[model samples]
Target: MVLPTFVLSAALATSVAAYDTLLNFHGAPEVETRTIDDIHKAAVAEGGVVTLWHGGDEKTQQDALKEAFEKRFPGMTLNLTVDISKYIDGDIDRQLSQGNVYVDSVILQTLQDYPRWDQEGALLRYKPLDFDKIHPGFRDVWASWYAVVVFGWTNIWNTEKVSEGPVEYSDFLKPEYKDKLVFTYPNDDDAVLYAFDLAMQQNGYSWFENLLAQNPRWVRGTATPTTVMAQANNSYAVTFTGALGLAPTAPFNVSIPKNGFFVTWGQRAAILKDAPHKEGAKLLHNFLLSEEYQSPNNTGMWSVRKDIPAPAGFPELMDVNSTNPIDFERFMADRERVERLKLFFESKIGSAQGLSPLVDDL
Candidate 1:
C-alpha cells in the first residue's frame, strides 16, 4: 500500500512530536534509566560509529580515551579529532549553520559555546548514565551538555633550578627568579588569561609591570611553558594546564597558590542534535560518565562526578582555597569583557608568534 507524499510527511511529523512528548523540560530524571549494556546494544544496531571533535593542543591527548571507549565496547568505533578549542568551536558553528554537522560530539574548553548551541536547539537533550552524580555546576539542567573532565592552570617550577617554589603569583617577580620565568601568552588562551587576570586583580597592574622586568620567556600554548621548564630550559612557569597527574617528575613540581586564586573550568561536552549516529554518541557519553572512566586513576585529573575523589596528592576541588570552577564559566560567557582583557594583555605582551601547538601534526 502506497501512501500519498503529504500523508507520509504528516505521519513522520506526528512520530517526531510523539517522541518529543516523552522528554521533560524541567527537572526530569536526574539519572539515566538505561544501562551501558542497553545503550551499547542500541548503538551497535545503528552501525556503531562515533566521531568526536575533541579540543586539545595535540592529537595524542585523547588517545587513552579513544582506546578505553573502543575496548569497553568491542564492536564500537571512536573516530577522534583533536585541535585547539577556539578553532574547533568555529568549525562546529559553521557546520551547524550549513546544516552539515558531521561530528557526533565535542569536548571543548570553550564553555560559552555550549549554552549558545543549546539555545539554538542544536544539542541533544539526553542525559547520560549517572547524571545525578555529576557536579551541579558541571551539568546542564536540561541535559543538553555536561563536562566530563575538570582542567585547570597553576604555577610550576624546575625543582632542580629553584630551591624555593612560588607560593603566590607575586613570588615570580622576586629578584631571584629574574630571567628564570617562562609563561604562555595570557591573551592566547582564555583559561591562562583568566589566571593572569586574577593575579592582576589581586596584586594590581604594577605587579605585571614588575614581572615584565623579570624577563619571562613568552610561549603560545599553556603546555609549552611546562614543557620548556621540564626540559630545564627555565626555572619557573605558569599556566601548567591539563591533567595534574601528568605533572613532570624530578626536575619539575606543580605549586598551588596559597594567597591568591588559580583558574579551573570543566571541559564541556555535548552531542549534536543532527548527529549521524545518535545512538553511538549516547553510548560514548554514558561511557565517559561511567565509573571505569571517571576514576581518578584512569584520567589522571579531577572527575566531573562529585562521588569520585580527586587524583592522588591533589585536594578535592572544593578544598582548594584559591580556585573556583564556576567563575571561569561566567568569565567565558562575557565576550565583551573577555575581548577587552585579551586586547589589553596583547598590548602589554605583544602578539603570540610562531605556529600553534596543533599545527605540527596537521
Candidate 2:
C-alpha cells in the first residue's frame, strides 16, 4: 500500500497537520496502492469504455470525479451517468430483471440500509490505504464495506434568506418559515431517514413532524433542498449534504448547526455481488478511496481520505461521540427490521418522492 501516515500530537484535537502521518487501523493501512499506472492506459484501450453509475447530484462533485478518474485511467473513458432516481430501490429485483447487473459499483446511502449485498453473493469488497485513519464507528470490520468519503447532514440556510431567520435548530420549526423550507424527502434517502431517526433520538418523533408542519418542500435528492436554498433564496433545508460543497462556484452556503444532530457520509460505496465489471469496478473503487482523487479542502461531508484534507468549506467530524451510530452487522442481518421501518413509515406518510412529478424526477 502506497499510503502515507497521519501523525498527531498528544493533543490530537489542537495539533495542526501539513500532510504528515499514515494511520493504521487494528493492523491494515487506511488506503492501499497497487501501482496500476503502468497498465491503466493499456487496460482501457484494450477494453474500450467504462461506465460509472454513481448516486447523488452534488455540484462540482460529478465533474471533479470524472476529471480525476479519466485523467488517471487514460485508455478508458468514464461514463459519468448518475442515476439518482433508482437510489437502491430493489437491487436484487433490478438485477434479476436486467438479466445481468446494470451498474459496476455503487455509492449507496449507507451500508446499514442493505447488508445482504455482500453476503447473498451480491457484492465484493476492497480496502483503501490508511483505512485506519477513520474512526472505528465508520470502519467495516467484516470487510463488507469501507467508507469512501465522510459527510453528514446538518441544517443549511441561504446566507441572504437566513440572515433574518433562524440562528439555531428551534428556529427551523418556527411557524413563519412555512412552505419556504425545502428538504430532501426522507423516504427517498435512507440517510435522511436515519437523520430523522437521529433527531428522534435527540428530540422526539415530533421533530420531523414539526419540520413537516412548517410546510417544507420535499426534494428528490438530499442535496436539492440545499441547492434551492442557495439559488432560490430559500431560508434553509437539509444543508449538510455534499451538494453544499460541490457548489463552490455558486453563492450558496451551508452551516453546521450548533445542536448535536449529525450524520456522516450517509452514502457509502460498495461493489455489487454480481458486478459484471468487478475487476474494473474494484479498480475504480479503490482509486476513489485514494487521496489522489479527493478534494484537498476539509469541510464538506465527503470520504475522509488522510491525504485529501477536508474541503475548505467543510468541518472535520469531532462531534461523533457515542450516539450509537447504527450497527452495520445488525442492519445487514436484520433485513426484516429495516423493512418494517420503511413499511411503517411508508404506510403513515408514503414516499416524499411520490408527491410531485418534477421533484420525483429530480
Candidate 3:
C-alpha cells in the first residue's frame, strides 16, 4: 500500500488541523480532584521547584506572593520572575515555539493571551479546587485559565495639594488642574490606553486636546503616576492602578469617576502545558484559587470567588457605578483597534520616555 508523499503530507495536515479544532472546542480533559497536600507531595517528588513568570511593573510587586507561597508549601520552592505583561507574553510565545519553556505557570494582566494560548494547546486544562465557586465571568468554561485578582484604574490626588480631586474626566481640563496632572503613557500600556479610550468616548476628542493643553506629566506605568501624586510632585493623576483595598488613603485619595466609566479586569492565571514541574505548577494554581490566598484581608482586592465578600468599604464589582469588567476583556480582544488607539494617544501625549517601570526602580 504505497502512498504518494504529497498525499501523506496532506493527510497529516488535515489530522493536525482537526485535533486543534477539537482542542479549541472541548479543551484538554479535566484532572481528578486532589487536595493541596496531595498536590504538594506529588510536586516535591517531581522536582520540589516551580518557576512562575508574573506580570507586573516591578519585582517587588510579587514579593507578597512569593513569601506567601513558600510559607504555605514548605517543601516546594517557587522561583518568581517579574516583568511587564507585554514582555512576558512575548517571551512565553518564544519559549513555547522553541520547545524550551522555563516557566511552569503565569499570572498576567494580558487577558487576551490566555484564550489564544489555549487554542494553541499551550495551557494545561486543570481546574483547581473550588473552580466551580469562582465568579462566572472570571473563569473559562474549559478550565484553561481564571482570574486570581481583580485590578482597576481611577483618578487619584494628593489631598494636601488638591483639596478636591477631579470626580470625572472633564474635571481634569479645569484651570485649577493645569500643570498639576500626571498620566501613564497610554501608548505604552493597553490598560492605560483602554482607560483613555473610555474617557475620549465620554468627553469627545476635543477634551483630549484640552487635556494636552493642561501640560500633564507623562510616565511609563500606571504605578508611576500614583508615585508622582504621593510625592506631591503632581497635585493629581489619572489611572491610579493598584489593588483597590491596598491603595493609601492618608495624604491621597483614589476616586471612582462620578460620571462615565472607569476600567477594571480580572488578572488571569494559568498553568503551562509544557511546564517542567507539572505537579508544582498545579499546586501553585490551586493555592492561588484557594480561600486562604484569595481572602480580602490577604489580597486587599476583590476575590474572584463569588462567596467571598468584597473588601471592607468597597462595593461588589457589579454595584460599582459606570464600570464593567467585561468591557475591558472585549477591548483587549480587538488588537487592531487597540493599536490604532495607542498611536492616536502617542500623537497627543508624545512617546513614553525613560526605562521601563519593571527596571526603573522608581
Candidate 4:
C-alpha cells in the first residue's frame, strides 16, 4: 500500500532541507571543534530544549547517547523519556489533538500512527544524509519517517536449558515447548503485533493460529520473555534475534529463523511543526540518522544505513524485507479493522486488565 500523502510532503520537505541543514564551519579542524557541540550551544543560545518521547526502558542507553551527543554538541542537550507506547492507540492522537504537543520527537512503532500522523500534518520532513541508502520498506514512501534501527525476531532459548535452538518460528509449537514458550504481549507491543501480522500475511492465517494455539504465555514488556528464559523460567522464549538485544547481562543467546524472520524498526525520529525548539529538533533528527553517532560499535540497533556494518555481534536473518509503507488514506480509512485485530489479540493472548487500558482507548 502507498504511504499517506503527508509522507509525500514530508519527503519533499526532507529533500529541500539542505538549506535547512546548517553548519558554520570555516576552515580546517580547529582547537575545539565538534559540529554537534556547536549545534548544542546554538540551541541553548536560541532557548531551545530537545525532548524526545520513546518506548522501551532504555534509560542507560539514552542517557549515554545524550551525554555523547551533548559532548559533540556541547550546548545541546536531549531530555529523553520512555513514554507510554502509543503505537495502536489514541494517546498520541490526543496529544496532537488537545494541542498539548510538547514532545519534539519520538521513537514508537509506526504500524498505526504513521499514515494517520501524515494525514494530520503533524510531522516535519527532513531526510538525513545518505537517505537514499536505506532499504526500501523502512523508507517512509514520502520520507515523513526514516528508520534509525531495525531489530528482527528470533526464538531465544536458554543455552543451558536447551541444547539446540528452534530453527523456525513454527518450531515453538513442538510438544517439547508446549506451555513452556513465552513471548511479549502482542496486543501491547506494536513490534510483536507486526511480527504476528507478518506471520499471517507472509505465511498464512492458519500458521499464526497454530503458533498461538501452542499456548505461549504472553506478558508485558519486550524484554520480559528474554529475561524469563535467561533466568531459566522456561527452556525457550520468542524474542529478539539474540540475548544481547536488551538485557545483555542475562545468560542466553538468540537464534534467527532460517526460512523467514520478522524484522521491526524502533527509534524512528521526527519533529512536529509546533515543536518549541524546531532547530534543536532538527539537529537531533539529523544526528540520529548519522553514522558519526551510530558508529559500528553502537550498543543498540540495526542501522538503516546500508554503508554501516551491522553491530559487532548480531546474527544475520535469512529473510530481511522491511515493512512496506502503508497507505495513510487506506489505513486511517480502515482504522477499525486494525483496532479489531489489536483487541482480538488482547483477549486471546495478553492480560485483560493489563492490555484493556490500551485496547479500550484504541
lDDT, candidate 4, 115-227, per-residue tens: 55655667665554556666665567566666666554555676676565676666766766666677766666555665676566667777767867777666566555665
Runs in model 3 deviating more than 4 A are 1-7, 14-28, 232-249
Model 1 Cα lDDT, one tens digit per residue, 271-296:
99899999999999998988888887
Each candidate: what lDDT?
Answer: 0.82, 0.54, 0.82, 0.58
C-alpha positional error of residue 283 in candidate 1 after TM-score superposition, expressed in Å: 1.5
Candidate No. with top TM-score: 3
TM-score per candidate, chains pooled: 0.87, 0.69, 0.91, 0.71
Q: Write the per-residue lDDT of candidate 3 for residues 232-277, one digit (tens) a residue.
A: 4435544344333535567767777757898888899999988999
Cα miss at 97, model 3 (Å)? 1.2
In model 1, the worst 10-residue window by lDDT is: 21-30
| Ten contiguous residues with the weakest lDDT in model 4 | 24-33
Best of the two (2, 4) by TM-score: 4
lDDT of 3 at 309: 88
Off by over 4 Å in 4: 1-38, 57-61, 87-92, 98-100, 130-137, 140-143, 200-215, 232-250, 311-334, 350-362
lDDT of 4: 0.58
